[model samples]
Target: MRRRKLLAGLAATAAAPLLGSGSVQADEALLGELLVTRLRDAMLGLGTAAAAPSSPEALATDFTRALADFDACRYASLAVRLPRLIRVGHALSTSGGDTEQHTLLAKTYLLATRMLVKMDEQQLGWMAADRAQQLAQSTGDVLAVAESARQLAVLARKAGWHDQALSIALSAADHPDLRGTGRAGAAVRGLLVQSASYTLARRGDRDGMRELTDEAAALAKELGATLLRDHGGGFSPLTVQLHRISAENHADDPRAALDAARAISLKALPSVERRSRALGDIAVTYDRLGRRSDCVRTLLAAERCAPQETHARPATKTLISSLLVSGPTSTELRGLAERSGVLV
Candidate 1:
C-alpha cells in the first residue's frame, strides 16, 4: 500500500505541469530529441507500416487528423504518428492505391518538412521536401508542386543557397499553370513571393525584399480574402503583413517590424501557431530594441498562445537565455525560464 501510494504521488508529480497553464509538460530537450529521432526514422522508412487503412477514405481521415495536430502545435503527438503515417503512405502508393493516395503522401511529406524546418532540422527537411516535390509532380497538381517549391526555397535559404532559393520561388510563382487558377493561384504565388522576400532579407538585399513583399502584397490584395487550401497554401493581406514583420525584423529594422506588427490584431490570424509565431516575432523585435520587459511580456503572451512553440523553438530559447544574462531578472522571468527548461 505504501509503494502504491508513492507510485501514485510520482505519477501526479509528472503530470502536474500538463494540468497547469504556462508550464513545460515535459523536458524540452527530451522532446526535441524524440522529434529528431522519430523524424529521422520516418524519413529512413525504419518503422513498421501501420496496417494499411481499410480504405482511402480512412487514410484521409488519419491524414486530416495529423495535419490538425500540426496546426494545433501538438508536436509530440505528431512526431509519434508521422513515421507510421509515412510508411503506410508509401505502402499505399506502391500497392496501386490511386492518385489520392499519392497526393495524400505528398502532402504528408510537406507537413513533415514544415515541422522539420520549424525545428531547424534543415538537412532532414530537405529530404522530406524533395520527396514531396517528386510525389507532387507525379500527382500533376500545380498547387502541390508550387507548395513543394516553396518548401524547397525555404530549405535552400536556410542552407545559405540564397540564389538557388530565389530561383526556385520565383520560377514557381511564374509557372504558367499558377497564373490562371484565380484566387487560389494568386494566393500560392503570393506565398512564393513572400518566401523570396525573406530570402532576399537574409541576403541583406533590403530593396529586393521590399520589392517582393510589395508584389506579394498586391497579389494578396487581389485575393481580397484569406486563401487556405488543404494541400498547403495559406495567404491573405494579413498574412503578407505578418511576413512583412518578420522580413523587417530580419532586415535589422525593428521599428518597421513593430510598425507592421502593430497594424494587425492577433484575432485576425487564422491559427494558434500563426498567432503565437507573430507574438514570438514581436518578442524578438522587443529584444532587438533593448526593451527587455516588453520582450519578456510578449514571450509570456506567446507562451499563453502556444506553450509548445514557446518552449520548443531554439530562437525563443536563445532569446530567453539572453534575457537571463542581460540585466536584472524578475521572478516571472525566472519562472518562465525554469518552466521552459532553460534553468535547472
Candidate 2:
C-alpha cells in the first residue's frame, strides 16, 4: 500500500503542472460557452422577431464579412457576432420573401458549420452542414451544396473517417457546377481539390496528393486576377502553396515539408489565419525534424500571427503540449508554451 501510494504521488506530481495548472487554455472552449448561451436564446425563439427586419442581401453581405473574420482566426469576435447573425439569418430564411433571400440560409449554415468545427462541436457541426446541404439542394444552389460538402469533409476528417472525407471532397470536385471558366467555378473546384490532397497525403499517397495540389495551384493561378463571390477571397495560388506544405507534413516527410515551407512567401498569405496555419505547419515540420528550438520559435511566430487561433485550436495546442513533454526543460520553450496557453 505504501509503495502504491508513492508511485501514485510521483505520477500525479509529474502530470500536475502539465494538465491541471493554468499555464494552458487547453479546455477554454473559446467558442463553447458563447455559442451555447447565444444559441440557447436563439433556440427559445427569443431573437427571431428582432432579427426579422434583416434583408437577404444584408444578411449575405454580413455573412461574407463574418467569413472574413472567421478566416482571419478572430474566433472570439466571430463568436460574439455569429449568434445574432444566425438569428437574423434564420428569420430571413423563413420570410425574406425571395429566392435570393432564401439562398443566404444555406450560406449562413455553412459558416455556422465551420465555426462549430473550430469550436470542436463536431456533432453540431455535422448537423449544421447537413442543414446547409438540404437548403442548398432545395434552392438549386450548386455552389452552396459544394460548400456543404466541404464542411462535411471537414467533419469526416475530424471523426477520423479519412477515406470517406476524401470521397466526399472528390465528389464535390466532380460537381457539374465545376464545369466552367468562371472565377467562382474555379475557386470551388480548386478548394475541394486542395482539400482532397491533404487526405491523400494522410494516406501516404504523396504522388496522388501532389497531383491534386498542382491541379489546384494551376486553377488558382489562372484565376489569379481576382476573387470569386462563391467563396470570396477564396482558394488562391498562395492557399495552394499552404496546402502543399501541410500535405508534405501530413505525409510524415519533415524534410520535404521543410523544403516546401521555405518555398512559400509569407506575405502572399493575406489572412491572419492562413498565415498562422502555414506557420503552424512549418512548426510541425520543425518538431518532426527534431529541431526543437526552431519548432519553438516557429510556434511562437504562429501565436504572434493569430493569438486567438493559436490558443483555441486543438491541433496547435496539442503540438505545444507534445513539445513540453518531449523538450528539455528550458526557459525559452516553457515560457513560449505557457504564453501560448498550451502548457503550465
State candidate 1's TM-score: 0.89
Q: Over the stretch 40-128, how does candidate 1's per-residue lDDT look in tens digits? A: 86678654443446777887887887777777777666655665578788887888879989998898899888888888888899899
**Candidate that scores best on lDDT:** 1
What is residue 106's positional error in candidate 1, in angstroms? 0.4
All candidates' lDDT scores? Answer: 0.82, 0.72
Error of 1 at 335 (Å): 1.9
Candidate 2 has what TM-score? Answer: 0.81
Relative to the true structure, candidate 2 has a C-alpha RMSD (angstroms) of: 9.7
Worst 10 residues of 1 by lDDT: 15-24
**Cα deviation in Å at residue 124, candidate 2?**
1.9
Best by TM-score: 1
Residue 227 of model 2: what lDDT?
57
